[model samples]
Target: MNNDERIHLLAKELIPLYDDLAADTRLVVEEHARTCKICNEELRRFNATFAPLAAKEEVEPNAEIKPFKKLQAFKALMVGLLFLARFLLIGLLVAAFDPAAPRLLGGNIIMFYFPLAAASLSILYFFYRKLWFWVLVLFDVFILFFLDEVIYYLLL
Candidate 1:
């Protein structure tokens, strides 16, 4: 094809990339085919079409948005530990419900304390560094002792 035909070809090819280029682009293609028989007419027929497309307001990037980061394994470990403690509490409560064990030992309140202490300790450990973690462990031990006493009383 000639030079004009080539410009038309470029416009036709690039038309699909833009919406306005569809019908208007054909007009451009036809105009190129008619005028400038010598070819190399760089008058830029789609200059306005390209300008509006370029100037179109973009969906601005979320200024309030924060970048995503993966949660640390330690965090997940702590969560799992807490959940385990919860399950333990639930199991103990189930055991407590059995009437065969006597009201004192098998009561829900005493059983719940075991799991509560465990869960509390797990949470404390997860949030604290190595130095402060011993505090949670101590509390956990204290809860166990308290529960033991409750059981002992109930047995008597």
Candidate 2:
């Protein structure tokens, strides 16, 4: 087709054509528009049509709807507790490996205290909405049920 017909055809394909056009093709089209009246008119029309969409009004955030500082603080506290839970887990593991731990801390210490502490930590994790929280809970459950077996195998 002629120059005017070609420009009209390209104008019909507006947004998708502009978006998907190669950089070299876009530069060529821009150069062509500067010299060609039909192409220049098409370019102006395209810009004018989308100008309102491009010129977005700045939206002021609602003053009443502030960030949840309390929730963030709660999450931070939960993270701190998760670290404390890991610390307790490490201590339990160390004590389980120690041959004299039972005699020193009393026979029920390994059987009771660590598991109880782990369960409490897991309960705390229930409030936290993170993958690590679930992982920690599962790990605590494993330790609660099978830690004695692990100690037996290790001590043997």
Candidate 3:
């Protein structure tokens, strides 16, 4: 073959390394590289360029996983606390529903209602973390106390 024809054949063989050639084209290229010194040299140069990238050290993330595990543990604890608070609120409400419950220091059942309302508000505040809910709870407590005082004055 002439020099131009030989160069053309070498270029065709190198096409598989640079681009995704057909399977038959890749087989033909590999066959030519096995016999042609020029094509073999080109293939070696191309493979050498990628050799460093393929031989890099892989790093293990053993130390970084500890913090992630700690975060998961804290998340589980918060969920447990939230469920506990909900159950306590439900138990308190059920106890208050009993007709035989004793009176507090003032002999007024209204006195106990304030602490129940406060506990419910605190639970809501802890779970939601919203300033608006806290503000509304405070406003409700104020209104409740004001209404209770007015009714007491009317009864007396």
Candidate 4:
């Protein structure tokens, strides 16, 4: 092909190469564009479309807004509480309707704790790496293990 035809074919890829192609490939395209007026103009036209956005400075959030809001902590805690309650809620529902549903350890009503604890730990999927996540998990484990005694003492 003639030099002009080669430049025309390569110019079509200038925009994509400039935006996202691998560094080595982009460098090769850029070298060709540097020598070809057509490719140079094509790349410049593509960049000009984004220049306005790139030139604009980002505004900071309002000073009144806290960056690390405690609302997240509250939400995580509330979800953790819900996780702990799910066991008792499901167990009570089953026992109330069936009246003959089996209980943990022959008579204890804490049978649901095992599966619910797994669900409770899964809360980390939402609150991963948060301080409240580990705290709630440990608390859930403690309650999971001692829920029978906890109920007995509460009744007394």
Clash number by candidate, in order? 0, 0, 0, 0
In model 2, the runs with Cα more than 4 Å from the true position are 1-70, 89-93, 96-126
lDDT of 1 by residue, 1-156 (tens): 887557866855664454445687657755764565422233344544565666675556775755334545666676577658755765575455444554454345555666676556666666655654685566556545564455556545
Off by over 4 Å in 4: 19-41, 54-75, 83-106, 112-119, 122-156
Off by over 4 Å in 1: 1-68, 72-77, 83-127, 130-135, 154-156
Best-fitting candidate, measured by lDDT? 2
> In candidate 4, what are the lDDT values of residues 1-156, reduced to their tens digit?
997677568657556556567787677677777887878888788788866765574456564655566877876686767765865664563344322332342233355555665665675656565775687678666665665455445444
Better of 1 and 3 by TM-score: 3
Please give the range of 10 consecutive residues that has the lowest summed lDDT in model 3.
98-107
Compute the lDDT for candidate 1. 0.57
Model 4 deviation from native, Cα RMSD in Å: 7.9
lDDT of 3 by residue, 1-156 (tens): 897577557666565455356687666666777777777777677768765655564447464534577766775686566546545644464344433332221234355445655665665576556764566577555645464344345443
lDDT of 2 by residue, 1-156 (tens): 898667555644543366457887677677667767777787778778866765664456564666699987987786777677666755765565656553433344456556666665655666654776677678666665665566666665
lDDT of 2: 0.63
Q: Against the hidden reference, what TM-scores do the models get? A: 0.27, 0.37, 0.29, 0.41
**Could you tell me how far off, in angstroms, the CA of residue 132 lies in candidate 1 after the best superposition?**
7.6
Better model by TM-score, 2 or 4?
4
Poorest 10 consecutive residues of model 4 by lDDT? 97-106
